[model samples]
Target: MGSRFVNLLARSCNGGPRHFSLHRMNPANLFHPTRSAVPAVQPLADAPLPPPALSFGWPGKKGELAWMNFMAFGRTGNNFLAVDQIGRTFFYDTDSRSLRTGMPMMCKPIMDPISIAVGDSLYVMSGNPGPSPGKHCFQALIHGRLPASDTNDWSWYSLQPPPPFVNDIPRFHEDEVKSSCGDVPAPYEIGAYTVVGESQIWVSTAGAGTYSYDTVSGAWSKVGNWSLPFRGRAEYIPEHNLWFGFTPNNLQLCTSDLTASSEVRPPVLQNMWTDVVRPKNWTLRDASLVPLGSGKVCIARFFVTHSDNFEDMSAYKKRENFAVLEGVEVLKAGWAHLRMVKHKSERYVFGRDLVIPL
Candidate 1:
């Protein structure tokens, strides 16, 4: 058994409370399922070069804040959109290596939102109305476009959230759950899923299930059950035909065919949340998937640990840890043909994939 699964079992066995949070840590990291349409031209033996290390500039600026609740990165051509916790949006022209200020999202006091870039346009799903406590804006999907020719002019556009999705939210709403249980209920959790060549963005609502938004047709439809449940994020390996979800507990996989099939086709592969990655003695902080231009992916998991002896709780440190996993068909269980590349670093910022023009 993988150490992560064993560790979780050990904690439960020892009567340590297992709590699930939608946030990163409590479930701190939020991930959007995305695909890079770039094809793998070479085999594993002649793996293409890894992407350049991301340059965020200063330590405490917009993109570098350690404590930001939610942040997402997306790029189209040479333009990179870095949206941080404070609703501030900055555009980076990768070609020029220059940063420019962009319009801020109108929705203030936003909860967890999903940001994605399609072509030269950026889409943000802000699920609530602004500045109101507990006011769920279940029907709003915000959009922004990076200038193609007009560099000086760009703003955010708002679109109605898929009607069926908005209407259905009231059914499994948190307020009803709390009232029935005679206590506060866990917050509603939302996660986004998408692919590079596909226009649909699949979103999962906690008490509810999975739903997909068609960017091309501008419609939403109720999908099936979520394949894997995690607090952090998910990544799609285009070459492997797999989607991987990262959480504090374990790493899981959702096959591409499984995601598209309305009914579970292959019994073994149906709802197959395969455990692929696991690390011992570390609390999973956040993770991002980077495609290494091969049929494999580099999974960077941020882990934090305190002194084992419990001498002082404040003596905690974060580490940058990563591993590369090659895609393979393992019929039974557990990840096969996985390789761990040792990396040691103290930097613990959120990691993400950025495709730049070569």
Candidate 2:
């Protein structure tokens, strides 16, 4: 096993839990099921109410605060996917919300990703990609599959998609192929996915450009050569029989069959929410893909920061008088002023190691 897989081995497998198997775990805790999708869990009354299975719980670490953005990882069990820090994808079992067994598929490091999916005997699409500082450089639109039962029997391939164009239509509804979302201040990471069914491939990219590699042909095309809007990332809701975006602030999106439309596909969004995790002063970085159960997703995001003036005018005034008497006299005293509140009681932030969900 690779180091990444090995390190998470005990927690993800062996000593911990295997893929979320309906036949294995508590059946009463499932979320729900999508069309042609699997059920993630059976509704359990005593368990913590999974906030609608609509919240996409995005996880991150800032200083000492481990920020978690959540959405209902809906029960239909086919849309959710996770791309670890490294470029690894783990398909989650819908009924169990656990990763599929024996799959640590060899893929590139997706810097940040949000969603993924597979169809037509191929990994049609894998994640939501974009141009945030937190997103990945997204060099290769690679594709391949391992022996269903053999990890060692894996195959890999690379791709070369086209460059990006401008979308200047303005506004989410009137969005052109070149409008820039204020959300992506700078290219951070690209980690999210959307489905372009008409093309028979799932396109992953925002602003950076569209990419759909034919698993069978091993060819990469910038078919939908428009912008991957920052307002939303790709998501397939099996239950709704539709595709959506996992943007922050509860915003849901609809995708065009990039394959069917002759012109650039128009992206539709639901004002239900928007990306709440806005950066202070960040840019596009990178992204990656992760497979939870029903399908997989790419988390494309960038590192963000905030700043404020902290100079003490009072101290400076005193220093002016001292300096007037002698150049050696100096004055400087200040400290950060900000209020922080934590919701979780656990002092330790990395609860996965200690909590052991599976």
> Which candidate tops TM-score?
1
Error of 1 at 6 (Å): 30
lDDT at residue 201 of model 1 (Cα atoms): 64
Clashes of each: 8, 133
lDDT of 1 by residue, 1-358 (tens): 0001000000011123321111111010111122332233312221222323233322244344321122333432224454444556665554465667645553542434555545445565643212222332332223433557544456655555423443444443444544222433322345434543567666655444566667787777777644334433455555445554444245444333435456233212333334333346555544455443344333444444434656553453232222222322223234433332222111222212211111
Per-candidate TM vs. native? 0.54, 0.36
RMSD of 1: 12.2
Candidate 2 lDDT (Cα, 0 to 1): 0.29
Over 91-187, each residue of candidate 2 has an lDDT whose tens digit, in order, gives 4444454554344533455432333223412231213223322222223222344547443332323233321221211123323233233343223
- The lowest-lDDT stretch of 10 consecutive residues in candidate 2 is 320-329
* TM-score, cand. 1 vs. native: 0.54
Model 2 TM-score, all chains together? 0.36
